[model samples]
Target: MLRETWAEIDPGCIADNLRAIRGMLPAGVKLMAVVKANGYGHGDLEAAEAARQAGADYLGVAFLEEALRLRAGGVELPILILTPIRPDQVELALARDLTLTVTGADWFRELRKRHASFAGRKLRVHVKADTGLGRIGFRTMAEWDALVPWLASPDIDVDGFYTHFATAGQVDTAYLERQARRFAKLMERSKASGIAIRHYHCAGSAAALRFPGLALDMVRIGAAMYGFHPARPAPPVELKPALSLHSTLMQVKRVRRGEYIGYDNAYRPDADEWIGTVPLGYADGWSQRMQGAAALVRGQRAQVVGKISMDQLMLRLPGPFTPGDRVTLIGRQGGERISFAELAAHIDGPAQAITTALTERVAKMYANAKEVRCPWNNAYFQQLRRVSDGSRAD
Candidate 1:
């Protein structure tokens, strides 16, 4: 709380990005905004509200805890837990009326064994069909086919069928196409079996923009909605970045020649250099490997030097600056600008990981919005009730 560092979130940008992504979808195809991982560390309730206001058909979260948080925030839209809920969490998912992801029959059988938690309340399910991602979901046609009979049970309501593409945004989509073919074949057979799944979604940001044909009934849009291209060779659609990270210089010091800086003497000044200490480090999600990443100081790019410490990092300031001078860590400043994508490239990681890995110490501020819409903590849900009785007090 003492640090003058915080992430500013632009709700308007989020709305605009979703609109742009929506425009690219084929007619009749809906958009399910993925607000998982605290909306990629941009603030979940804020992003979810913006996406809902922008006409998102569904909101996606990673686990039952996030779904419950959204439900408590009065998010009434169809919220689906993208990850398969733990066996112990199924009851809470059903209790919150949040859709659950069913990977295979064995997971479903485990749920059935604990049916007493259902308490006569029907749980909506989404069959996660794994075409090629190979992490989770129905791997083979036989696995998917075997679950069809159990899906007909009154215990669980199968409402949607979808898959995650391994490489939807890359220039080469050979594997993505193969996965799409597998998905189509499965869907065609499911249709022949008379299994009426409501929503069929594949394609995240990249797949949806590159292959609209992959859009059946809905597309789970995530990174694109936040203005980050899911793949390189940018698509034609317009996207406005919604988040910007900022920090301030805590101390400015002059380093003489031959002076070693940081752990392991990672940086040695060949000449006298003005080094500014920024009160952010790997613990703040900047990552120890992020040393040498650039930040904007005095409207100019300042190269990070030395190894990043747990609570601090050194920036080679363009000139000696005051302690309170604002530093743009991942945003625009004067004529110079930096972005999460650039930082990720410096570290050789996905841009999303940079944002999502940001720790809670960093504050999140909202812009282009009237008031903050924060989700209630567990304190608000101390008095949990059954779904049959109207779920949470929300």
Candidate 2:
């Protein structure tokens, strides 16, 4: 690892999380493990392999390239793209056997014009119905039916039909019920019109946990599968978190009273205190708003007390801590723990964004039966090793 900071991916935990979440699903319902955004920055290939090993019925991603990466990485499972694909990318998607999201009839026509690019291979696709979210997909039944002729064009195959809920995890169920009804109505109408879809899914991680009825033929799990859903009203099914961010406190310096801590003198030492410089900063996805947020140092809370720089942040040590001491940015250090919710709240955002924002500079270490790199000698790795070995890490 080039940087002291790295994200540890616990495949065992992911496997456990998938098993727990899958138990809550209805009989015959499948799971499409969402590994988009590099498995939410936990390393896509590693998490995909883990999820597949844990009995994931399918895999999902946002971009066609992500599907290509998985295919290249020896993932031969059925993969679907959650987002719509560009007309130009359809050829590659067909070549790689990646499923495309059919948003509208116009997009379908564009794909047909380039149908010859498929090299005689039938293109697999999924129909997306925009129930309530004003994001993408067809809003009305007419929009969905407009593409009916193309569904049987022999150039494309509509393997799945799905929709997304605008509010699934919220306390209110009125809107959630409406979205479900709309999606069901549209899907039934399609069936009545002779559109045969192999798979039908609507629930993401939150929906699958909160509304078990939406577990149609498959449930696309992303955050919940990784165990990072810190939203209100926690999931009933207990999930093991699969990712943790950690860094090494490589420098311990004694700052005199009234001395500035970081950039622009944002913090001043009240008294002569020992400060540890953590070798991670905003550039590594540790946001600047995390200045006041505390990390774990030697099983104690170390409050961040300075402006976060591009490559470093300052932490007020609880006691005399030495260089090479471990720091927990989003995990447990002894009894103290820093959660994704806390970090997101510190930045006024959602929990999942924290992981996706992590850049490629931060190396990802996977804790599976198979090991790679084995770079760090930090406490996090030691704990991960124990956990991967089927012993207790926490």
Candidate 3:
């Protein structure tokens, strides 16, 4: 890439992470690789291909546009849109063979008004139960009751029923247990209605990794598939980070003790010090929130000394460095490393926020692309082979 700054994505690492997570799951349970937010900014198509090569059964995205992008990229896997698409977009989603997340009956009512039928095609859907997340989903029984009739329509297929846990990553499991119980009850109610829901799932990456019991028919793997996990009660399986950020020292100079640097005089050297300017800044997703964070230079930590600018940021170097010296913004350099968790902790946010915040201006250089290969002997792939062979039997 022309830009000196870039994110290195290892598709092999993503594949390995999925394989490890798959090993932790129960037999026959499916894995849905969540590639939302452009695979948490690691590149959606790359991540999906990696997941598919690792034998992922499904793919998940946050928006219709994202699903459409995947379809355009030649991804033939079943895709589920985690968020509700607009009623008007139902036909578009159907045309792409996309599964949708249905939260309430109102959305169905609106869709029916627009298109009385799905044009003889079964609209695959996953009904989302709020459980305890308080985000999206049908919470009350009345809401579920209102939704049942629409789900039972001849033109609709109840492909799945699921919910999200709010505190699955936390140490305390009380809230998570409650949410699980509520989801179980909801599933029981849905089953009592005689509607044949094909799959039942409620666990995302953290929950699925930590509690395999929560992995119902499928587990949605997102953050952990990229080596991000909960801080408390560490994950059982080891996962390698698939993404790393790097840049070069655009300029290096010796600043006098009294000389201020950056806009608004955000920093002043206490002593004559070596400073390096990196060709990346807030505009590239390295926001001002990372002002005091550290970068790796010459195998040592260099503090970000000034207010981050739109196109550049200054670092308090360990010593004098060349203009083109390599800077490790989020990766290992010699003996030093700057991890996504460290940066996320600095900003008091999720590790994913650190990666996903990275703007497109910073080029992505994918690594280990040739190493992504599926093991056909694995149970998951064996089952797929059997199904494929059976399909061609007649």
Candidate 4:
């Protein structure tokens, strides 16, 4: 961590959040920890390990590369690629025992054309039904019917069927109910087909916590696992945020009244005031839109007073602050706290956007490495003998 600005991630908080969510779910229902986008920029491997420690049933990633990375890190929990993978990449996925998300029949046809048959293991897959999100997945019964035969192949296993809701986090329940009804109809169709789907899930973090009945077979917990509740009024479970950002004042100076600061004269001091520079800017995920947002300097709010530059931004300090003083960008300092929700409200986006936008240039420091360990004991792994065989399966 050469840079003074870094994100501090608490894996124990993530594990605790997962445990709380699990307690809310039904006994038979599973929890799919969504660790995509580098665990929403909290570090993919670390988040996955935290989920495993909390007894997560499955892991979800958005791409094949992400699943491969988790496998390389010795994550044995069943992994489902939330997005569809290329037909040519099927073998690579199969070799790693990765479950894929199938949207339509054409993907299977192309895969079959590439390889006459899968050689060793049954290709595990989850059928994606686009109830309302409209991002991907089969929308009509006809599309599902077309994709069923391909999924029924002996070499393939229909491990799960799932959908995503567009308005799960919104106050309005009308659209969410409509989408749930549509998904229910699709599930009936699937039942009639007798494809033997193992898991039927439609609820993400918000929907699962808001409506426990919607937790059909599994809930994909992403934002909630990171202590983000997208819904209003909050859910019953207690979730603590796992990540916080901090930096130090790189430079401090006094500016005269009416003197412009930063590029294009974005700001001018009303009087002789102290200005502090932080070594984080738009390039580190602090965009220009955050110009007027506040950062905590010595437990006091300091308004960002100038156009955020590529690598640094100036703040109107509450008073004179020395260089190397600690600045809280998204965390607690004394009695003042700058939360991700507060920052997201400024940007008018989901809390995760602020986290995922953090570029690799901003270093990440894990706070609790010892507490979040593998839940499985040595005897458990020894009995499975997977460790000796280098097989990632439980």
TM-score of 2: 0.91
lDDT of each: 0.80, 0.82, 0.87, 0.87
TM-score of each: 0.91, 0.91, 0.92, 0.92
Better of 1 and 4 by lDDT: 4
Name the runs in model 2 displaced over 4 angstroms. 1-3, 116-120, 368-394
* Model 4 lDDT, residue 363, Cα: 67
lDDT by residue for model 3 (1-394), tens? 1346767788899999999999989999999999999999888999999999999999999999999999999999999999999999998999999999999989988998999986678999999999988899999999998998998899999999999999888889999999999999999999999899999999998899889999999999999999997566778988899988877787889999999999999899889999999999999999999999999877789999989999999999888877767778898877778887788789988999989989878766666443322322233322322332102111
| Model 4 TM-score, 2 decimals | 0.92
Mind giving the per-residue lDDT tens digits that candidate 2 earns over 1-394?
3445777778888888998988988888999999999888777888898898889989999988889999999998899998988988877777787888888889877766766435577888899989998898899878877888878776678899999988886788899899999988988888987877898889998899988888999999998878877658888877777778887777888999999999999999889999999889889888787889988877789899889998999999977787767788888878778887788778887677888888876767766434554465556455543442112224
Q: What order do candidates take by lDDT, descending?
A: 3, 4, 2, 1
Candidate 4 lDDT by residue in tens digits, 1-394? 1346767789999999999999989889999999999999899999999999999999999999999999999999999999999999988998898999999999988888898777657999999999988799999999999998998898899999999999888888999999999999999999999799999999999999999999999999999999986436588899999988877788889999999999999898889999998899999998998889888877889999889999999999888777767777887877888887788788888889989998987866666453322244434423332221112223
Go through the candidates in order and give the clash count of each. Answer: 0, 0, 0, 0
Residues 144-205, candidate 1: write the lDDT tens digits.
Answer: 78888878776667789998999876788788889989999988877776677899888888
Better of 1 and 4 by TM-score: 4
In candidate 4, list every pair of residues with a backbone clash. Answer: none
Task: Give the distance in Å from residue 55's predicted Cα in candidate 2 to where it truly belongs.
Answer: 1.0
